[model samples]
Every structure is written in structure tokens, then in C-alpha cells.
Target: MTARKEEAGPSGLASALVASGALRSDWLTTFNAVPRGMFVPDRIWPGIADGTRQNPVVDRVRDPVAWLRAVYSDIPLTTQWDDGSHSGDGLGQTPSSSSSQPHMVFSMLADLDVTDGNRVLEIGTGTGWNAGLLAHRLGGGNVVSIEFDPDVAEQAGENQRNAGLCPLVIVGDGRLGYAEGAPYDRVIATCSVGEVPRAWVAQTLAGGLIVAPWGTLYGGEAIVRLTVDGGTASGRFTRSSAFMRLRQQRPDLPRHDVYLKGREWPADGIGSTTTLSPAEVGGWLEQFAIGLQMPGAFWTVERYDDGTYTLWTYSTDTLSWASADHEPGADAFHVVQSGPRRLWDETEAAYAWWDGQGRPGFDRFGLTVDSDGERAWLDSPDHPVRCTDP
Candidate 1:
């Protein structure tokens, strides 16, 4: 056991979460029951409190104190990298699984709003700490968690057993919520998805709630708490988030080379300048607003050593591309557009729409999903957010 003086423990984390208003008094007992340390693997890459970047691995065997400190901190812990293919302790290209930030976990559970006998179905079991917490709160029989990765599910089961909680952990596609546990009172997803699976809504009770991290193809994400109503579900975003993309819903974007077609910079592309700096649209809320309007669009940035960079926007179909050049202390920035769609203009228009709406935050944006598919709205469902002529 790690000495209390060496590092902050559960008490420290609980106090921080409580101070943040994420760890509610109702869930405090369950939080203590399902200690995150037991569910965490021997090796992990600790993430910073506010951002997504992960630090190097901290093996409990190698350094117990550091591991304990990381375990208790209100931050994510990457448990699997590249779907468990990447070997050794070094960082991997993509983080596939993790023990989510304690703040996020409890906040989402609060969003879930479960009652005493409510049946719950959780997508993406991951480390099973969330499932364990739920199981501890509402008995093991009332909770069912599904994970796509078999090994991850096995480990999660082991962790649950060790923690003295056994929520049914299914090894299957999370996008297809387990039908065996149909008509659940609550459904929650640990991972983020570009689109909410219809199965999740279908399996949930009519008046039940589904809390999931939803993002757009362009950029930006937030926790959405949707209330299931007949064959439709709609709700506003609760808070900003940056969860890993759900594996199946992950978009495979076309490469920059495909858009360039082996041509040099600004080859046969229209050139223009705009007063709007590239930095203005890079914020989380800005991206979410822009993403809602700009469908089939995504962005990447190429930075230079002289405090400048080119913001590249690409269409999924590889038919449209845009670039905005950003330099320090400049009122106007150079812009280029190629192919049919003027991606930069669309983005600017979207940003303008958001700015015109008095720059409302995530709370104002809501999503409606039905047989007609999903539609994002600014204030009400009638006024759907859509692309404007740029």
C-alpha cells in the first residue's frame, strides 16, 4: 500500500470533484465503494486535467507512488494504445481505451440521473470502473455494460471481480446496444460518437434517457443528455468534452495529398484575404458551432517555427479543400480555395451565424434524432442548424 503522505488519495480526488460540483452527494458513497485504483491496469499513461494529451506510461510495478498519485488525480488514464497492438511503454499513435477523468465520469453519471431500481446499459466498458460504480450504486443485476474489445472486456470483468462488483460485461459491438437487456431505463456511452446508434434509442424505454458524448465530423464534442420519446430523441448539450471517437463511427478522412492531386501550394486555387484570424475559429465552442453547419468537413493545422501556421480544411469526398494562412500581429490573413466547395467561406459563414446568435454556448445547441436522421438546432427543434450560402 502506498503511504498517504507520499501522494494524494481518494479523499483528495473526492474533495476536488466535489468542489467542481461533478461528484454529487448522492454518488459519493458509490464512488468510494468502487475505487478507481482497482480497475486501472498495472500500466497507464496519465493525462492532464483539462486537455487530451497523455504523459508517458507509469507502471505501478516500476513506480508505485507515481502510479497511485495518477490513479487518484482527476484525469484520464490511457490503458490501451492502438487497440492493444502497440508494444512497450512509449506513447502510441492513438489512445484506444482509458479510465476516464473522475470529474467526467461522475458528471456523466449525474447526467444519467438513475434511480434505485433503474436498469442501465453502458456502452464501452473500457476499464469497467464506470460499470463498477454503477453496479455499486444500483445492484449488479440492474447494470449491463458492453465492450467491443474482448481482451478489454475480460480485464474489466477481472477488475470488477477484484473490486467485489460484477456488472454483466458483454464483449460485443457497442454501437448495437445489447438487445437482451432491452427497455433499459438509462443508457450511457463512455466513448464518443458522431451519430447516436438507432439501436440505443430502440432498446431504451420511451421515457428513459440516453447520455452520450456526441461530436461532429468537422470538430468539437459535448455530453448530450437525450430523452427518448417514441421513435425520436432530442436534447441540448450539457458540457464540452473530448472523448475518443467510437471505433465504428470514426471517420476515415481523405489525406491532404488526395486533395492537392500532387500539385504545389495554391495550384489553380483562388486566393483571397479575410480579416478573420484562423485562431478565432479554433476554440471548442466555435468548432462545435461551425461543425454543426459544415457537414462532411474537418480541419488540420501545419505549424511553422516563426509563430505561424496554415489551417487546412478538407471535405470528406476529397472534392473540396481550403487553407487559411495565419501570422502573428496581422489584421488580415491569406486564404485559398480549391475544387467545388469553398470550405473556408463555409466555415466563415458558420462562424458568422454563431456570432450572430449572440455566441451562445453548448447549452443552447441541441440535437434531434429520428427516422429522418439527426438535425442540430440552435434554440428550438424547429430552427434546425444547416449550411448557409457562402
Candidate 2:
């Protein structure tokens, strides 16, 4: 084992969470009862505190102290990679399952506002820590968790059993939501989704709450708390999030080669300069507003050695693409756009519109899902953002 200084324990971590206003007073007992350490695996890729980046793996048998510290820390720990298909000591292509950050767990639970006897349906039981907490608060019989990965579901079931919690764990698609547990008083999804599955809304009883992380293809995500009523659900966003997306709702994005279509940089494209710096539109709130305005669009960052970067935006249809060069301390930025749609122009317009609205944050935004479709709004449901064609 590599020699390293000791870190905070579970008690210290709990104290810190309480001080940070994440662990509520009402749920303190459950938090203490269902320790996250019990559910986390021995080998894990510890994630950074604020971002999604994960460090190298730490094995409990090889380095017990590091494992303990990772478990007690507020950050998330990636347990399985590539849907448990990749086997290695190093990181994999993508993180498929993980134990969510403790702060996000408690905050979303607070949003759920579960009662003593309220039956709960949880989607994506990755590590079973959430299911254990729900079972500790409400009885085990009242908590049901659904996981799409069979191995993940089995591991979660084993973890819950070892912790003396018996929450029913099922291996199935979360989008369909377990119908056997229909008419639940509360429904929560650990995964994010672009569209709220109608099954979830249909399963939830009227006046119940459905809390899930909702994001756009353009990037940026937030926890949405919707109240169900008469086949409709609408609520305001509680906080920003970056959870893994639901498998069924994942978008099919075209490859860069397909977008370029064998053409070189700026092939048959228009070139222009903008006074607006590309850096200004990279914030979490800015991305949320821009994504709300422009559907079916996504972005990526290409960095250069000289501390400059180009922000590339593309339509899912692989028809339009835009690139804006951002240099430090520059008032004007160069832009190149191609195809029928002008992505950069639409993005800049959305940013301008958001600025005109006093630069509203995530709290001001809300989402409504009904028969027509899902619509993002600001301040109120009636003021829906104008959706443009891709």
C-alpha cells in the first residue's frame, strides 16, 4: 500500500454535510443509519468534488485508507465502467455506473419530500445506497428500485441485503418504470433524461412528486421536481446536475466525419467575426438557456497549445456545424458556419435573449410534460422558450 495521510471518517463527513446545508435535520437519522461506505465497492475510481472527472482506481485490499477516505468523501465513486464489460485497473472509455455524490443524494431526497409511509419507486439502483436510505426511512416493503443492468442490479441487491435492508431490486428498463409498483407516492430517478417517460407519470399517483435530472442535448442539466396532476406534470428546477443519461433516452449523434462530408475546414461555409467572446457562453447557466432555446443541438471543445480553444456546435441531423475561435482578451472572435442552419448565430441570439431577461438562473427555469411534449419555461409555464428548427 502506498503511504498517504489519513483523511476524514464517516462521522466527520456527516458533520461536514450538515454544515453545508445538504444533510437536512429531518433526514439525519436515515443518513446516519445507511452509511455510504456499506454500499460502495472496494475498487473505485474516485470522482472530483465539483466535476465529472474520475481519478485512478483505489482498491480497498491494496489501499484501505484511500478507499475509506473515498467512501466518506462527498464526491461520487465510479464503480463499474462500460456497463461492467471492461475489466482493468485503469479507467475505461466511459463510466456506466457509480455511487452518486452524497450532497446530490440528500438534496434530491429533500426535493422528493417523502412522507413516513409513502411508497417510493427509484430508477437506476446503481449502488443501492439510495434504496437503502429510502428503506431506512420508509420500510423495506415500501421501497422498490429498478436497474437496467442485471449485474448492477444483483450487486445492489447483495449490498442492500448485507446492510440488512430489503428494498425490492428489479432488473429492468427504468424508462418503463416497474408497473408492479404503480401508484407510488414518490418516484425518483438517479439517471438523467431528455424526456420524462410517460410510464413514470402514469404510475405516480395524483398529487405525488417525481424528481429527476433533466438535461438537453446541447449540454447542461438540472434537477426537475414535477408535481403530478390529472395526466400532467410541471415543476421548477431545483438545482444544477450532471448525472449519467438514461440509456433509452440517449440521442444518436452523428460522427464528425459525417458532418464534414469529406470537406476541409470551412468548406463552402460563410466566415464572420463577432464581438461576443465564445468564453461568455460556456457557463452552466448559459448552456442551459441556450440549450432550451435551441433543441437538437450539441457542443464540444477543442483546445490548442496556446491556451486558446474552439467551441464547436453541431446539429444532431449532421446537416449544420459551426466553430468559434476563442482567444484570451479578444473582443472579436472568428466564426465559420456551414449547411442550412447557422448554429453560432442561433446560440448568440439565445445568449442575447437570456441577457435581456436579466440573466435568469436555473431556479427561474421550469419544465412541463404533457400530451403535446416537454417544454422548458422561465418564471412561469406560460412563458415558454421559442424552439427553433435544427
Candidate 3:
């Protein structure tokens, strides 16, 4: 390993996470064994930024430093696009694959309770970072990772080979899990699932643990940990994470014209009155509430010569949201208000509720999943059920 990567080893970051109570002492070897830099290419954004994702450009034969930093950093790197509509040959807006952030992967693994000799099956073979960690910890033969995108799968295979950590890397829809490797000690998904695939639960050995990111109707994402009981599995939200929306479940981009047409004023006591940017507020909703409330506003952030800012949210349902500079005020933006759902009201109310809760996140939300589906409660097992969605 290079000197720079050596400096970022599990010793420092692992110590920090342990001090913060995010990780334990025993898993340090997994961190050391898998040099994250080897999996990532050089010159990429550490996290998603701007109006889209942060791109990590790789030139295997050139710019080794850039590659090393991205590889070693605990951040995820986007790898694929449009679920094959775009090619992994280059980078673009659509991110179909990624090497998930190290801290997040570590956190998820800690939650999985992976022990020595554990037979593990991982979903989403993105950049193969998680698979590397698993293989390092539990011998190559004990690890199996599946990816849906064929090109991505091939690339990940190459990365795994380069890292000299080999496992059963397969290109297949993860929704089915790896039936041939059923009864796994642990099944973890690096990708997000709109719903807990029933096949995963059935395939897990009774008492085995399944960790996955579950998408909710409320707009937020939660890491759910389920332990198979009888034929059912039950667990709760361990944390909050955002993954590129699933291929089959990606929301249909609403009609721009239809949304614009509904931009109007108050009708039947329902109108847009808030001076908050709906985009910021809505994204916040995913973090604050269980995602039951979705911000119905949108905006284009503009900076003025006077150092002022302008933000707006327009919808075809006649409900428009706008905000300006200063402590959350907007300029002479537009508002067309009319909708059965009262988009602004729902958004504001959810925001208010989030504030009331003091902005709890994965630290507060607990999950319990079984054959019946999944439920989101608070931190304590006895806490009030917050979300029960499929």
C-alpha cells in the first residue's frame, strides 16, 4: 500500500468510529484487509453533489494518486448508469453502480454481526468494496456477491481480481438472492430495495440476519436488520442512507408541463404560503420524518450580484412553493395553488412534525421485518410504530 493510503488505515478512522460508538474493536482487521483505494478509480467526487452525483473518473494507467484517495476514502463512488441504458464505459448523470462509502459499509457490516467463518451473500456488487471486506474477513469461499448490471458485474469482477480477493461474484438480479447459496449466515444488500424482497427472507437460514436499505412511501430510506424467526424475519431501522433509486422502482420523472401548469394561487383555502425552498425542505423531509411527507415544491437556486438568492417551487396542481435569501425568505417567485393533496400543507406539516421530534434519524427509527412485510418504530422496541409499509 502507498504511504497516503497507509495513513488512512483502519487504525485512525476505526478508532474514531469506535470512540463515537459507531464500530467495535474486533472488525478492524476487515478494515485493514480491504484497501478501499484499490476498488475506486482516480478523480471522483467523494459524495453526490451539485444537481446530480459526483463523478469519479478513472485512468488506471495514469493519475494513481487521485485513484488512491478515492479508493481509500470511506465514500461511495458511482460506477454505472441508467441500468444499462447508459454504459459503464464512461461517467454521466445516471449512476447505476458505485463503491459505497467505507463508513457506511463498515456500519452496515457491524450491524450484520458478521463473525469468522460466516457464510455471507451480498447484494449489489457495485465496485466490490463490501465484497472485498467480507471476503477478507470470512475467507473467499464464504462470500458471494451478486450484481444485476452485466457490464458492472464484469467490471467488479476485474476489480476483485485486481485486489486479489476472490469470491463467487455473479451477475444476476439480487431480488432473488442467491438461491444456490441459501441458508446463508448473513445476507446484506448494498443497494436500496423499494420493498423487502420476499425471496431474501425465505432464503435466509432461520436465525440468520439480513441487512438491507428499504425505501419507504414517506420518502426516507432506512437500513433494516431482520433476524429470521421460524419462517419470518423481524428487525428495525439501524440508520438512514440514500442509495441510487432501484432500477425497476425509480420514480417516473413527473411531466414538466403538467407540473408547471398547476402552478397557481390559493383555491379552497389551500395555497402555497411558505417562503421555504421546496427542494431543500423536501429532501430534508426524507431525513426528518419517516418520509410520510414529501415536499411538493421545486426550485432553481440563483445567486444575485447583490449576494442575494432566489428559489421557487412550481407545480401543475396549482400549488407553487417559493423562498428567497436571508433566513429562508425568497424573492417575487410564483405560486399556483390547487391540489387535492394540498402538497404545501402536507410538506409543512411534516416539516413541523420533524422539528417537533428534534430531528431524529436512524438513531431513532427501529425496524421489524417478517413475512408479513416491514414496520418502522422508534429506537426502543416498544416505541410507537411510525411506518408500516410494503
Candidate 4:
């Protein structure tokens, strides 16, 4: 009851999505039929439009109007936190499951490009809303969804049933796509992955599409739509996205202490000054382009009370670490490099290459996955993206 009442509903959201072109005309009917409200839970944390931050809980029993408005809004609703371990309506350490933003849902569905009678397999049946949407599009028998968490799968099934849809909801690892429904005409993943699972490619039919959110170790992610070839699947990133990382693929990165190894500020580290402010390279696209070249690298920030901060970059293996001091209203920034690899230098070089290529967006970058592994390319498969080695 504490939640401020707002004037919102499905019609307003639908109109906004339609104007934005994310709610395409072809899928308009199913979009309306499969109302998102049915799939949302009693209590939820709604997220910001373009950021990962979440708002206070809006419980259906306590604030039905607020809950209804949140369910119909274009933003995501976090249904589970810390893998369902956290409690008490406050934000959790990490968001585990969610009903994805309506805009993103329909956008990815558009990328799926499904036709009548096309068999589809979806990874991460979070709330079954997506599965319900697909089931409504094709028949219930044509859609299969996999969830790793048994509890989540059970709830998703209940939600689907309540919505009058019966997509096969299986409790299993999403990384290992359900083999029982092999040779699917389309495979879509609601969760993001560091690497595309080979099983997804193997299970998909030739010429079928696999649309999923893909990210790198460094940072930044985008939706990639791949066409399954005889053995491999290759395609370009369609749009920027920030979905919850697949539980299996979640990284256990090395600690900063491991990299420091008892060294204090600038200890045994070479000091250098650079014209490139750390702020210049913090944009989403910049991170994506740099992550393509600087594999096994990640960053953290240390802020000072006076509005200045240090951007700390580290190599996954603790072989290298770099720090850049960024101060407001400053033309130059100080940088220090230690260990074997120059992480900051590699990042700068990657950014320069992206700039050299006219700063191509997500659409210009492509991915090719085969038995060997996945490789990123600038425009086409032939022009493979080069890695900045130590």
C-alpha cells in the first residue's frame, strides 16, 4: 500500500512498444493474447529501463495497482534473487530469475523469425511467459522450454497453466539444451551466456536460427542471431542486451588480492601518463569492442571521496594488472602497469581498432561458432577479430 499509485496498463505499454517498433505487427495478436501480467508473481522488483538497478518490491496483495502496472510496463520484473536464497523484499546480491522486459522479449522473438508449425526450443523458462508466448504462436506441442532450477520450472509450469498454455517445461540444465526435442526449427535462449553451448547448435536444424544474448569476460553484451549451418552457427549481433548470465557459465574470477600479491599503490608497477581518460572507454559499445580483443580481462573501479576514481583492470590469470586515475576536469590521466601483460594498453588498442572501423555498432560485429570454438568478426566471417596478446 506504500507504493505510489500510477496511471499505467497494458494498452499504454502496447502503444509505446508499437511506436518503438519492438512490438511488430505480425506478433501483435499473440502479444495481446499472452498478457505478461499472468506470468508475474505476487511480489517483484521492477528494474530500470536501460540499467540493471531495481526498485522496491510491489506486492500484489499490498499494492495490486502498482503490481499490475509493473507487470505491464516495458521493464523487467525480478522474480527471484540470489537463486531464490535471499529474502525480505530488499535487493539481493544478484538477480537470478526474471520476467524479461516486454520490449526485449518481443524484439528477440522478432529476431527468432518463426513461422507456422516451426518447432522451437527455449532455454531458461524463467516465468514461462516467453514459453507461453511461443506456445501461443506455434502449438503447445511445438514448443519446449528448459529450466535448471526445479522450483523455478514448477512455478513456470503453474504460470503457463494459469495462462491456458501448455509448453513442455522440463527441469534440467539449460546449457545442455533438451535433446528429446532435437532438430528444432528454432532455438532461443532467454539467459545470456559467455559461450554458446555446442548442444544448442547440434539440436537446431540446418538454416534454423538461434537467438541469444552473448557477452564477453571483460563486459558488455548483445543479442546474437545465428543461422545454423550443417555443423556450425554464424551470425551478427542484433541489439545490445543485459540478461542474467547463465548459472552454469557464471565466472568465478580471480580476486584482486591475487593480482596485487602484497603490493601497495604503484608498487613494482611502471607509471605512465596517457591522454585517454578512463571515462572515454567505459561506454557499452567500447567495452564490447575491447572485450572482443582483450580476452580474459575484467575491470573494477575505486572511487575517492573527491569525485575521482581509479579504473583497475586485471587479467584473469593474475598475470597482469593496470590502473588509470581519472579526475574530473582533467585533460590527462595517470596510468600504471604491472606484471607481464599491459591490460590498459591492450584495451586502448582495441578501442582504437573499433574507432578505425568507423565505430561499428552491434550489427556490424558477427560471431561464428564451430567445433573448434567461437570467433568474433568485424563485418564478415572472413575478417576475424584479432586478439591482443601479451
For every candidate, C-alpha RMSD to the true structure in Å = 2.9, 3.0, 5.2, 3.0
The TM-scores, one per candidate, come to 0.96, 0.96, 0.77, 0.96
**Model 3: what TM-score?**
0.77
Cα deviation of 263 in candidate 2 (Å)?
A: 1.4
Q: lDDT scores for all predictions?
A: 0.91, 0.90, 0.65, 0.91
What is the per-residue lDDT of model 1 for residues 1-390, given as tens digits with 9 covering 90 to 100? 965552478988988899999999999999888889999999988984222354778999999989999999988888888888977788777789999999999999999999999999999999999999999999999999999999999999999999999899999999999998888999999999999999999998999999999998888999999999989999989999889888998788788899889989888789999999999999988999999998888999999999999999998889889999999899999999998889999989999999999999999989999999998897899898986432
Error of 2 at 276 (Å): 1.5
lDDT of 4 by residue, 1-390 (tens): 596543587777888899999999888899889889888889899874222355788899999988988888889888988888977877777889999999999999999999999999999999999999999999899999999999999999999999899999999999889898888999999999989999999999999999999999899899999999988999999999999999999999888888778878788889998888899889988899999999889998998999999999999888889999999889999999998898888888888899999999999999999999999998899999999763
lDDT of 3 by residue, 1-390 (tens): 655434544465565566666556677766766666667654344566322543545654576655554555556666555565654434565666677766678788889998787999998888787898788888899999988787777877888889888989998878888888777989998878767777788888888999988765435677888888766777767777877755655655344345445534222333334554444554633434625434333334555677555433333233433333333356423333444444445555656666677777766766666666655566665765442111
Candidate 2 lDDT by residue in tens digits, 1-390: 996643567787788789999999988998888889999999998884222354788999999988998899888888988778878987776678899999999999999999999999999999999999999999999999999999999999999999999999999999999998788999999999999999999999999999999988888899999999978999999999988888777777887778888989888779999988989999888998999989889988889999999999999888899999999999899999998889999999999999999999899999999999898999999999887876
Residue 348, model 4: Cα distance from true site in angstroms = 0.9
Q: In candidate 3, which residue ranges exceed 4 Å CA deviation?
A: 1-24, 41-45, 49-60, 84-91, 260-290, 293-336, 379-390
| Residue 318 of model 4, lDDT score | 85
In the predicted model 1, the residue pairs found to clash are: none
Please give the lDDT score at residue 280 for candidate 2: 92
Give the better candidate number (1 or 3) by TM-score.
1
